[model samples]
Target: MPVRPADIDLAQRLADAAGAVIRPYFRRPAGLETKADQSPVTRADREAEEAMRRLLDAERSGDGIIGEEYGEKPGVTGRRWILDPIDGTRSFTAGRAIFGTLIALVEDGWPVLGVIDQPVQRERWLGVAGQPTLFNGGPTRTRACPALRGAIVATTSPHLFAEGDVPHYMALVTAASGGAPRQGPVYGGDCYNYGLLASGHLDIVCESGLKLYDFAALAPVVEGAGGRMCDWNGDPLTADSAGHVLAIGDPARTDEVLEALRGAVDDGIAHDH
Candidate 1:
């Protein structure tokens, strides 16, 4: 079901609160710590998440919360909020403006509303299921690209992919370039890539090994902009979806991209043995 406008407003407030806490730490030397997975975390990530949680607790205490910095907090209501306070921590630490705050509302295990806020750049993209995506106070839609060749796909990095998954990803990259090199899939955007895809700047994005908080907010943003986002097998993304995700700005190209990616799935599966 579609979220009410008031709830969407609250989601915006959550993003704003997170941005306030994160902006001061960006580009500054933060106390960095490594997680068990070896991914870096910083004070910015923690404090920002705390800020959003504080607001959620006071306003919608009955809603569940899942955050990157903190552990999950279940609520009586079936609805939940998923947060990545600073989606591109590396970019923020590097003083780049590509970092964003991701806020999502998932009800009954499906995402229904989302926001991608780039605080440094002062750009915001808001999406509600079954409604037009809004970009900085205006409705936005993605650009159309009917084929993989010259589609301008993006991924955060090949390193994020598993050893067995890299070949499959490269196949799609090759398909995008049609075996020739002329601005193929660009790298290094993180959540910002999805916002760009929604605003008609990027055409496709594929990534693996994402958590619910990592990907939940992106689907509504991409889909609300007249795009389609699904798993590698072209299944609609849900709370239980596998980490592999594909977002295509042009709805017409979803099947083609999925097919190209699937062509190497057998190789990926075999290599995993």
Candidate 2:
């Protein structure tokens, strides 16, 4: 059967519910807690997940839900909803505007609907499995940068990227060729940067130390907008495990960027280990 396009009405509804849950908590203190990894969390994360779950049951009653806070719940629909209620909890807790909500509808493990709502940013980005992305309900796609010399890249933790992520980071820096690659370390919004890439505002976004919820929503958005997103080995992403993602408007150019980054990171890892 043709995958066709995912249901937009359903996609928007899910994104909206997540956004609605976070609206009141935007910049409001939600009381933070420390996870086992010492990462920050807040009531907003938990509350947002709960609210989304309720809507999922009512709207797509049979769909399985995989969330950040509550983990996976029983669902019967062939489609699975992968969500990160508040991706940038650290930023959210600190009252930064970089945080946003990520949701993706996956059919048989492939994301066919991706929605990224940056409520505080007042931007709602979404796209179904085989279509272009929409920003605020308008058509959108990544900007083309033919060469790596001038690509601009974003990453969450540059310093921590040194250990295992060195190859991926190095590939990015070299791919820039001559274009300036800027790094202003900002935490949270793992999916937002991919949204930015889909909108033609960014060249690449790298991620490591991510869970399925962290990258699921983002994979579809970036890919839907005429870009390619995958782990370091060039595998398509799913809602699981920690891996590296290289997102760019053009695949050929992105591959060039990837090769350069891989070499650089390989050298760095070789030196360190």
State the lDDT at 100 in candidate 1: 93
lDDT of 1: 0.88
List the lowest-lDDT window of 10 residues for candidate 2.
Answer: 264-273
**TM-score for candidate 1, residues paired by index:** 0.96
* lDDT per residue (tens digit) for residues 83-194 in model 2: 8888888777777777778887787777777778887777988877767778898988888887766677777666545356655575566556343335332334566787
Q: Indicate the worst ten consecutive residues by lDDT in candidate 1.
A: 264-273
Looking at model 1, the pairs that clash are: none
TM accuracy, model 2 = 0.87
Candidate 1: list runs displaced more than 4 Å. Answer: 265-273
Q: In terms of TM-score, which candidate is strongest?
A: 1
Cα RMSD of predicted structure 1: 2.1
